[model samples]
Every structure is written in C-alpha cells, then in structure tokens.
Target: MTTSSTQQQTSDAFGYKWARRDSYESPAVRDASRAWLLSRYCGGDAAVLDAWLAGGPKTILDAGCGAGFSALLLFGERLRDHDYVGVDISSAVEVAAQRFAEAEIPARFMRADIATVDLPPASVDLLFSEGVLHHTDNPATTLRHLAGLLRDGGRALFYVYAKKSVVREFTDDHIRQQLMPLSDAEAWAALEPLTKLGIALGALEGTIDVPEDIPLLGIPKGSYPLQRFFYWHVCKAFYRADFSVDEMNHINFDWFRPANCHRQTPEEVRAWCTAAGLEVETLRVEEAGMTVVARRVSAGATYV
Candidate 1:
C-alpha cells in the first residue's frame, strides 16, 4: 500500500478502536495505565509529574492524541492549567473534544496529521505522543517534524514499539497483512479467538527455562512464563488477568489491525532523537517498547 493509504487505514482503525472507549475505560484499567505512564515518564513518582506540569509550560500539544485518553490519564484536572491542543489524523478528535467538553475543561482539538500539521513552530512547550510515532509512515521523519514545533529547551515525551524476536516480528506482520482488507468490525471479530487463546495459555501456570540464549531467534536464556515465552518469541497474545475479554481483544485488535505499526531498535530510536535535535534525558527500554523523555536542543535542526 502507498504511504498515504497506509496512514489512512491506520487512522480509520484507531478511530474505530477509540469510539468503543467504554471497552477499556474502566476504572481499574485507567488506574493501571496511569501507574504505568507515571513509572515510565516520572520515575514512578506522581510528585515528579505534578511538578513538571506546574513548571510554567503554558502550551501543551498532544500529537496523535487518540480520543484524548493519554492526556486525560496524564494531566487530569491539571490540563486546565495550560492551553491544550490535541491533533489527530482520525475522527477520534471529535470524541476527544466532546470528552473534554463534558469534563468542563477548556481545550482545542484538530483533525490533522501530526507529521504535516499546520502548527506554528516554537509555539509549544510540551509535546506528548504516546505509542504513536511507530504507527506513522516514517517514524524518524515524523519525529523530526513534531520536534521542530517545540521551542528550545521544551520537553517531549513519546513511546514507540521495540523490535521483538524474529518469529514474533514476522507473525505480527503476517497477521496485520491479513486484516488489512477487512472492515474494522470484521477485524475485531476475527481477533476474539486470539484473545481466547491468550487466556487459555495464561491459565497454564508454568515456566520454561531456556538452557541458553538463541541469538538467531532473539530468545534470551531465562525462565519465562508459558504464555510470555510464546508471546515474546512467537506471536503477541496479550494477556492480563485483570482485563476483561473485550479489553484483551481491544489490545490484540490494536496490534493487528493497523497497517503501519513499525517496530525499531534502541539504536535507531536514539539516532532519530539526535537527528530531530532532541537531547535524550531518559529512555526506558522493555520487551514491548521504548519510552522516551527528551528536550529540544535546536529549534531549526533537521533530520540528517
């Protein structure tokens, strides 16, 4: 598919996903997500995040904000303290606007591609793009464009998927390709079996000890839970006992329905940051992805 078509498909998939907000908006899920976000961005200290938000950043940009969930999870009432702008490539921005309106929060929402959105350069003080860059046509180029909108010394916090085992990577691509032609509803229905499989695998309480590292497949030597071993080395069957079946399916659909879900290595991510004139402050790498906190160092810098 062409880049534009791929992005459009991705946008449509996410729009459908976000519209079913109630599927994943339970209190338990919100708390868990908030804790994870804090751990990654604020060193597990809510005070750190609070202080940063109160640190005189007058304007905040939520790039690729899907239904404003991340912003709501991160900022809460503190969002009212700044001029918040949410830009998304899909219709989810409408949901975001309605949500903020109902919450009595003042904000602006725009439906536009973050990579080429018309926003004044150096007008933003804080930019947040959670799990978004990887879904773009070119993550590095997109980052460069978003970073250019930040003033010198402004901060950006974003996340991207990390490269997984060779088998898992291939399986992910294969699944996504198969779902590309299906409507969003059909794709969601198709993922139910995978979610059930994840539950079944998760129920088998056992661990496997790999005798040694299998570098060829990226399987490290260690004891892994049965479900996790397959999840990390084979295909993604996201399982969390706390989440409902639909919630689990929501995650699976999120992973498999998008056409532009790119995964990258830590080295590549760091290079993208450097090329975007961003100075990395903290970069946390996990089996799933990388979370980054960076500050803009040069407003006019371009990707090399």
Candidate 2:
C-alpha cells in the first residue's frame, strides 16, 4: 500500500465508530489477560503494587482497566480498606463484572475514557496503567487528566513505549496500514507472506540476541514478513499464548486488526509529567520503554 493509503487506512481504523468499539469489546482473545496480570502486578507489576503498599495508600484506580484482570492480584487479600476501581472504555466491563462477582471479588468499574473521565479530585491514592495510554489521541493530556484525579502525595505508575524501539512499531504501522484494511478473513489470509518472512528472519543467527537490535532495514530480516516474528516475540514477552497452528493467525489478527496503538519513550514520559504538572517520583527506562511513578506536586505525601 502507498504510505498515504496506509496512513488513511489506519486513521480509518482508529476512527471511533461507537458501535465498532462496542463490537470489539468481547472478541475472543487468548488469555493474555491472565498472564499480563501476573507479569504486571505480581511479576514485574508487583514492584508497582509494592511501591503503593509501601506508601500506604487507601484507594487505587486502575485506569484503562479493560477486563479488570489486574484486580485479580488482590483477590482475597486484606486491602487495608483500599478500594480498587477499574475502568475501561469498552463493554468488556459486562463480562468482567460477571467474572469478578463469580469469583467473589468485588470491584467498582465504570465505562469511560481514561482521558477525561470525571472523578473527585485528590480523592484517589494511587493510579496504575499498563500499555494503555498511547492508544489515545493524546497520551500527555490523558496523563494530566488522571493526575488531577489523585489525592495529594498520591502516586501513579505508568508504562509506555520508548524511543528508538523500531521493530514492532514499524511492523505495527505496516500491518495496520497495509493489512488491517482487509476484512478479518482477508487480513488473516494476507498474513501468510508475513509469516513466511518472519520465520526466515527468526532464523537469523544472533541478530535478535539483544532487545534493542532489530535488523530493521536493508536485509532479508527487514521485510514486513520478517517483522511479524518480531511482533510475535514481543507479544509473547508479555503473554503466554497457547502455541497452536492457529497461534500466529491469532496474533496477527490482534496486532493488525486493532484500530489504534501507540508507544512512547522515557524522555517523552518525563516531559509529559512536567507538562501535566506532575512531579515524577521515579522513572526507570528498560529495553521496552519506561516504568514511572509520578505525583502531582500539589498533593502532599504522607507515610504516616
């Protein structure tokens, strides 16, 4: 596809057709949500929760809550009366509501945009988001909105994309522009060439040994097909998918079919904190991007 067509195609996919948004809500997805919850809150994510627990917050907000998978982290545990609220923009809340109620875990959830959802200012004690912000039209603005919802001295943890991370970003754009415009079945079929190409790239000796190294250009590994392997691996990094003949098909469908996705960097994140009037308490940039804990300066901190 021409670059212009690709751009136009992706924009169309990102278009907020309310019904389409509603339709995408409960599509059969592999259990990435379960693995994601483990890796985030208790695995790598536990560090985030530990920080808040250390800070002794009494309330928490899981912005962009999606299916409320992370809420499972605190199941059956004493929360010091800290209430965790998970919010998402999709009707996935209905399914999540049933699951949580069945599991005997009660959490408050609402359907709203994380960017402008209204809540009591200075009411929340902590905010947590993972791989959620960049999908919005304005991540920085979203940060400002969420930050305003926190109580003084309350902290927020965020994970977002990084600069110079080219592999998936390239393939993501390529698939959305070149591939997502096709019907679901057509898009699924179009992935064959990309799959063959990705297998070929996966065969490269040691090219992918480092997280930052992507044979991104001017090589057999640089083709759109090869990039598909990169996407699969990056995805598997966060999700434990059941390996099946149809697994690649499923990954391709999710990666390409998603109407919108975005990635950001540590520096850009810090800038967003500054621009949003937040004082970052901590920020660690790893190979993927950044893990940040920031607070609104007006909110005073209290450990006691």
Best by TM-score: 1
Give per-residue CA lDDT, model 1, range 216-300, as digits (tens).
Answer: 9888999999999989999999899999999989999989999889999999999999999899989999999999999899646
Residue 236 deviation, candidate 2, in Å?
A: 10
TM-score of each: 0.95, 0.67
- Model-by-model lDDT, in order? 0.90, 0.58
Task: Write candidate 2's Cα lDDT for 3-118 as tens digits.
Answer: 23433333333332212333332323324544544454445454546656664437778887655544554333534346878776666555556656776766788877787777
Candidate 1 yields a Cα-based lDDT of 0.90
Worst 10 residues of 2 by lDDT: 236-245
Q: Model 1 Cα displacement at 85 (Å)? A: 0.5
Clashing pairs in 1: none
Please provide the root mean square deviation of candidate 2 (C-alpha atoms, Å).
7.2
